[model samples]
Target chain A: MEYETPLFFHVMRYAVRADRDVIDMVSGNPDWEPPEALREGLREYADLESSEFQYPPSDGLLELREEIAARRGVDRDQVVVTNGAGEANYLAMARALERDRGSEVLLTDPVYPYYPGKTTLLGGSQRFVAAGEDGQLDPERVREAASTDTSCLVVNTPNNPTGAVYPEETMRELVAVAEEYDAILLSDEVYDHYDLSGTFASALGVESENRIVTDSVSKTLAITGFRVGYAVFPHDLAEEAKSRHMLINVAGSRPAQYAVLDALRETDPAYHEANRELLAERVETFTGALEAAGAEYTRPDGAFYVMARFEGYPGTLENVEALIDDIGVAGMPGEAFGDSRSDWLRFALVTPRVEEAAERLAERFG
Target chain B: MEYETPLFFHVMRYAVRADRDVIDMVSGNPDWEPPEALREGLREYADLESSEFQYPPSDGLLELREEIAARRGVDRDQVVVTNGAGEANYLAMARALERDRGSEVLLTDPVYPYYPGKTTLLGGSQRFVAAGEDGQLDPERVREAASTDTSCLVVNTPNNPTGAVYPEETMRELVAVAEEYDAILLSDEVYDHYDLSGTFASALGVESENRIVTDSVSKTLAITGFRVGYAVFPHDLAEEAKSRHMLINVAGSRPAQYAVLDALRETDPAYHEANRELLAERVETFTGALEAAGAEYTRPDGAFYVMARFEGYPGTLENVEALIDDIGVAGMPGEAFGDSRSDWLRFALVTPRVEEAAERLAERFG
Candidate 1:
């Protein structure tokens, strides 16, 4: 259990202090607005009875859970609305430990930093498999890394930092490995709508008893601040998930969930299509900028991040600080993710200034 | 750790299945209207710039933190807004364990069940001290129970289930005991505004590094679903609290924060005074009915719960079920609180029909 502060927060801290001119290509906070219906939903919630404002059920609002269950093609009882995808992930891992499924939670290298932090918080051990050069998890690698002691495997599709989406084949193999070890598969698909390629496949599509798919309206609706998320677990695990959800944070935001519910009713494929168009364009611009900067990097298959090795410098904390100071552009160093690639940097194209961020990198380090 | 579901949820589940007319004195879901300003706040928040809907900072919105800090007479940096007091409590206990301050979290018997559940989730042990006959903590008893192995003491003032608000002298003595044991004192003041005795004293009223006061707008504003709460920590402990807060739930609800921020800005003592007046009326009516029923009970000093022992009936789970089934009134069993008071039943007078619930109990058992 390392006490390393995740790099995104560090960059945000710097960004908060940095001059207004500085470009914050750091944290994965979406800059886009949530769906208009979600905004309108707040107005509708405002007009409802005050009971709507009071403490919702510890599990969640039934209507919101119903909406999520319908969307995920699961029964309403299988869904537990959460504080965010963050809380959902925590519950999934905690359930694995509580049920004696395993003692350790496993993930791949270049993982989401908070996964490890959460595992430590629950007093569970963590192990990692190494992803291939493309930063996409190899099924064989995951199989090799897993053991009978592994309690859960956390998989992030349309992955953060590397922008690698797990395909259907990869997802099945991952599920198989998890089942073999009696491990739970925690699929964090918060970035599902950010996929630029057509090959993205959700673990939910595979339908395993061990799969717990966690997601939020953060990236899809661009309302991370609303702090609304949900997870779908096997029916047997629902009670534990609900209890853990309540103990962890009580319940998700009620008004926000209502807003999301309203948005859900009105959400069109065009809405997701439109958001992907924006993220997809930004990925191209960001990758182009990386190429111009003479940085060695893999083009992202999905999601909105690009990982580039800063050839001349170590991606140490000091180097990251220098990059933030010298170039007026902020990004997280690869060291923040794990010991997997201390030489690279993670650039998030969540900002509107994707092209300028790209140009700035080229001008500063090319 | 036992896999005991808290009595609130169990009772709530029963209430949900029982007749619609069944008086739900089970959970502390406040059944009053929030201040008009709080509702107006939602509309104002509804119209805010879209950035308000986007992810707020992991710590919290500065405006909300500033409001909380001002109310608590602390610097803004001392506050970390949370999902609710639930998450705040979790973070405080987790910080105690992580820092090696103590190995076990101590509380008075007839404790809030979630505290022990959270300790178990964090892989920490829980210990208990027997509370006074009135369900109020006695300093000598706490001192006797505490040991060097104690890491934290969770005190819910104007306490839950029992509704015994800790007075200033007792609070000071409790703080002294905690300081002696090098244990953090987590004061849950969510029910601070419900004081009927006018003897409410805050742990924050006596400043010390060991005192981390947690609260939420849930009980105070009757907006439990909004999921807005905060904890005031010593500046040294603030960092750990913030890290745990982020890892647990990332951030509090965004639009809910905005709505609460607006409410805080306009909240007058008159508002709380009005709420207390209503609760005071309910308490008198409910307690009178209890007396008529030949039930022995403690009149709450603060908060809206009453603990009563029905004549010649042991308040076990089966008895509680019979009470709900026969009387159409749902209340929690005292055994659900802790092992200390198996003969008593806990009743929440949060609903408007407090007199009806009280009357039904009298008719059934008197």
Candidate 2:
């Protein structure tokens, strides 16, 4: 196994230096604070005696699973809490691919990088289906890419980098394709709550036996450091996913799960709506600036990112590095997302200083 | 690509709830409270801003790694925090086997079940060296097991189930074998602090580059639920372990790491000593009761477990299940540990109800 370093995070580390006044528009970390209720839940649970800190039930705490199921409108048995959305994705892929030798995975071009990284590492090949010019995943392309060798299709709705939330029609079509091909659909909805368009489509309700939904509170509840995430599987795959999840990390942190339970139980819908509005404001301000700077870009429907192509600058790896070191503005090279055209860069909208980042980009490329 | 269910833990779960009033002496869980300082640290960290709850550094938080290094008496760069000792073991095995395709892992008979479980799952074969009647590992046996195919040796000091603390001289000899064979020594010292006879030994001080130590606060600090463990590896293997750790589960929980850090820094030595004394008392009482009931057992030098053999009863899977279902006392079947020809069952002595448990066993068997 030739292990590849997580280069995107590595770049983020380099860009977040103390001396550099860089405007970090890298990594999909939410800029807003977690809801007060959620934070208090964590605080309250943390203060409890250490006895409460023992190993969580291998499947997950019943309360947490029940809350997640209720929120997703699924059965509690369908959910398996994992280390994070990363582990959930890995488990879903492992469950789907391990059974079939020479299985290829279908991933949308410019998809979340981990889909390919994990697939390749797990002895599975990948087929990249290019997204359309509007920065939205094309169901027809995905259908065409499906073949006998493809065992899994990974779809990240409210997708990272492009923030293209799949509409219900698109999701239904994709789910239908997966059902037709008997391929497992691994849907990553980590950014589900960050949908600025408020039209988030869930793969869970897609009436397909092949769907596995991976999600986390990292983006929604802002508890990424807590490392609590989950997967909801069809009845057929739940046991295998549960077993693999136990093998992966035994269980995630106990206090984190308890906190998640409390948060889901107590958090107000107003908090989520307010956060979405804030992110929408940032996107507007930033995209307006990009237009002024004459950059070709697609405004995200959800998630906190924009895929912008600098007209004069063909965004190569060298250019990406130079922007971080020389220009002091950190963004992901689009090439990292997929083997698509490398002329685009991804700027994260989930930064506190979005206005300043826009100003910096304008200063350099206006 | 055929995946087997995790056998050891799966069996343990069955044995846990099989009987009413089952005295669980099977699993290696310590029945003690986490240090007050560690709990307080978690409380303090839980109240931190949501940004503090964002994704942790992939390798680990620097301060926690530094604390681990200082505790292990090694440089900070050598340590990488992991999900738990389980993940540490898995990561080390994966790294070792990944480096060499035909690599074989060596373990001792009556070993920690995870060694075999993880090795086999990671695409590596394992060879077991039998332990002496005294439950002590022989360095000569380890040397005999080493061959050109051997890639790593998994050793647990203050060994799990058996509780045989390997002497420094034996470790030195094993270290010599590791150096001569150019094989990595993956030492599990999760039970380091629970050494009853004050004879705990570590491979960290061994003058060998081919050594990795897997340990955690689960056993030492009595917070198994926290899932905070680490692997201290030679510089050559550090990067691989770190990368795998991140890919496997990103990192352990942030607040848990902070709690462990505080436990290491602020907790008094007396707190640890008190935990040790309590465990020691339980072991002594439990073993005495077993002996009076005509059960033959090895007195553990350290850790919270004792492997006992009943005179007439062979510790098969069926008998272990009967003990749980009929006698309401759960002890791990010796078969789960290894293929050794002994009627041995494991007893965890960390429970607060040790005296009552002993009396119950005495009444049943005496």
Candidate 3:
């Protein structure tokens, strides 16, 4: 009855204190500076009126909500700023349950594991639809799985682990299924800006009354620690979202909100272009090493990761462990994400030493 | 069934867009600057390794937890850092419910309004124990209320709304009751630093296996918007607390954690002393005006609020509305806190113009 894997922490703890040369790629922590405008924003916020730090308006500061609304093409009241996309997802799922929307939550196999955990915490059941090779959602299969008891469907595009950037047609079909079944479609589009593939479409773009889009300044701005995110809700669910937000975390981080507000206003489109380009180069270099090692990998269309299978061995937890201990290279096991794929190992090319890590893997696997 | 009142926000919202001269005694937001050490800390954190901006460790930064643990006299593992005490309390209550510890959550009648709302959200029923005349707990009343089905009891010392700082003997007896019934005792000591009557005992100071202490820098440091707090759970419950925290909010504000760490390291005891002194002055000035106006009220021992009843008026929402519209002053009605008090109005002494607010109240009531 005790669920105690510590999830991603179990994979990263060993490498945290290891020698500096050890290549740690088990987590999604970005390796880049946030926009300079954020730091400049912090300096200005530090001198605001003393009461500026009061319990911020529970839904969020109006100014920040206004900005999020403008960016998403929603009204200010439709936005509920949250601690992170983490909390935004929690609020959405909890709302679905609270309103008797459904006790059954739907997810994709090879899922971001945290989705299942959040569903469990809120006392709801999860049923995942397996993705196609390289993590593409099969819209027809998803539509088949829809039922009256399904309360929610979660889609993470520019998806994690498999790294597929969902196409607009697929996204439209997903939204249609949610609308047809009267179930909530909760999308975590925090990585929308990092659409390495130009075909990525946001649920926010093709609006439906049942769609709830959760996003954060974290991935794009590289400020995950600041904990400022938002959920755009259907107008009907907006009040519930606000109340639930208050009961859960009260409000998002205030200083982070101000900093992000400034960053959003001042950040040049070129900043996002540069980051996308950097990820593309890393993906090419690391996947090339896998190809040379005689390993089979699915090249990702967007996110900075590739899923590969080492020749002569499946990617089990033990193999992941040995890769760390024997080669000083760490990676996430596919099984850690979902039960569907134990043969695939997930590698994040987030570190500057991706080439070295790939060379080490090629030395043994080749 | 729709719990629409956003509590603290309902009080503060009216004044938010009002004239600058409007005195808002509706919120506990302090009218003072945080320690200068926090600003200097920000400057240092601004330059940390780029990965520092990535997701923080889910439970919290080890260094910050270690500091909180040392100060609270608990081991680092017992602390689960959360997004403000809001999330800490949510995790604790949800854990209690998830384990089937009990079906009901107990609270003082004049409770912090947020408690009942949280218990409801987690699918648990709420039971109330009415406070004594001055909003103090009579150990016997609480002991008599205890039952095997009571999953948890929340005691906020320097109680919000009433400001009753529970006596050590009362706290000890309350813990004994929870021990006998084997129910969790959640002590929210966020306001302990504001103890004016000098009688504050942490539930941590009295050992009990079924207890959790939720604290935060928000109230003490005057930065509720920072959204960083922690809960110390029984060793057996620590894992559940961590999992629930991750599922709810991932981690608290990361940059705030670093800044608070530096502030914790450099803050002089003199700083807290000065803050306590200022609250003492505000309480005196405001309450003196209450007495002169012939209003019936109970003085608070800690925290920065006083409960008073204007002659011929039963502290209803309508009365509060009149106060805001007629006098440009805002306050919370006691009915919002609990159903037991329909005749008492709660006024926070947080405004810098406590004297002016008091003068306005006296002119109208006297």
Tens digits of per-residue lDDT for model 1 on A206-264? Answer: 87898889999888888878878988989988887787777768777899888888998
Candidate 1 or 2, higher lDDT?
1
Model 1, residue B2: distance off in Å is 4.3
lDDT tens readout by residue for model 2, B1-366: 434454556556777657477666666667677777876787788677667788778767889888888878988888888888878878877777776734799989987766776776677888999988787999998998899788898888888778789988888888888788788888899988878877777998786788888898888888888888988888888887776676657777887787788888998889889988887777789888988988778888888777777767777878877777767777777877787834787777756777787777777778
lDDT of 1 by residue, B1-366 (tens): 345456677777876787657888887888888877887888888888776677688888998898888888999999998988888888888887777866888877889888888888677788888888886788898888889888999899988878888899989988898899888988989999898988999998887888899999998888888888888989988987787787878888888888888888888889889889998898899999989988899798888788999867877888888888788888888888888888988888888888889888889878
Rate residue B259 of model 3 by lDDT: 82
Q: Chain A TM-score for each candidate, in the given order?
A: 0.96, 0.96, 0.96
Among all candidates shown, the one with the greatest DockQ = 3
Which ranges in model 3 have alpha carbons more than 4 Å from their true place?
A1-6, A17-20, B17-20
TM-score of chain B of each: 0.97, 0.95, 0.97
For model 2, the superposed segments whose C-alpha errors exceed 4 Å read A325-327, B1-19
Full ranking by lDDT: 3, 1, 2
DockQ in order: 0.67, 0.61, 0.69
The candidate 3 chain A region of ten consecutive residues with least summed lDDT is A1-10
lDDT value, candidate 2, whole model: 0.80
In model 3, state the lDDT of residue A150: 88
Ranking by TM-score: 3, 2, 1
Q: What are the lDDT figures for the candidates, one per model?
A: 0.84, 0.80, 0.84
Model 1 misplaced stretches (Cα beyond 4 Å): none
Candidate 1 lDDT at A364 equals 78
